[model samples]
Target: MADKVVPIKEQKLMDVKLGQLPSWLAARDYSAQGIFLGFKAGYDRFFNKYINVKNAGIGGFAMLMTGYVILSYTWSYSHLKTERIRKYH
Candidate 1:
């Protein structure tokens, strides 16, 4: 029979040891999925883990609002800077 494969997070929760604290924290998944989609992995994990069906009214709204404000400000600031440069040159 084939042995069951454990997920990284679940394996950490189930079998981590005090002596292996340093190594455990330093360990990373080097699988193709983890390596190729590192940024996407982290992004998906964060949204899946923290921004779920529950609290969509509170935390989700807050996160969306904050992201909107930040991106809008950044775009406006960059546009203004570019306009200033265009005026000079």
Candidate 2:
């Protein structure tokens, strides 16, 4: 008798492919989830469709927004004031 291995299918959700993806990502187990999620989310340059606030929670969103505001303000202040400070006498 000869030994052989058989594969089993687990929890697969139905989806439609909008475009073709490379075979490498399909073969990679670790990256498969990310690829699936990215497609589901409609991965454009901006405006990602799958904005999961429930998963992130209010505090997480707040912190992220706060960080964005703080960084932007700092960048603007630095660029707008740098030349003025150098010229001040």
**Among all candidates shown, the one with the greatest lDDT:** 1
lDDT of 2: 0.51
lDDT (10s digit) by residue, model 1, range 1-89: 99787644445534866776666656766788878787796678768766766655567658868989999988799677877766543
Query: Global lDDT of each model?
Result: 0.70, 0.51
> lDDT tens string, model 2, 1-89?
88443222221223213332343335435578867875665534123322443454466457558879999988799687866767555
RMSD of each: 7.7, 11.5
Residue 33 error for model 2, in Å?
A: 23
lDDT of 2 at 41: 50
- Give the top-scoring candidate (TM-score): 1
Scored by Cα lDDT, where does model 1 land? 0.70
Off by over 4 Å in 2: 1-56, 79-89
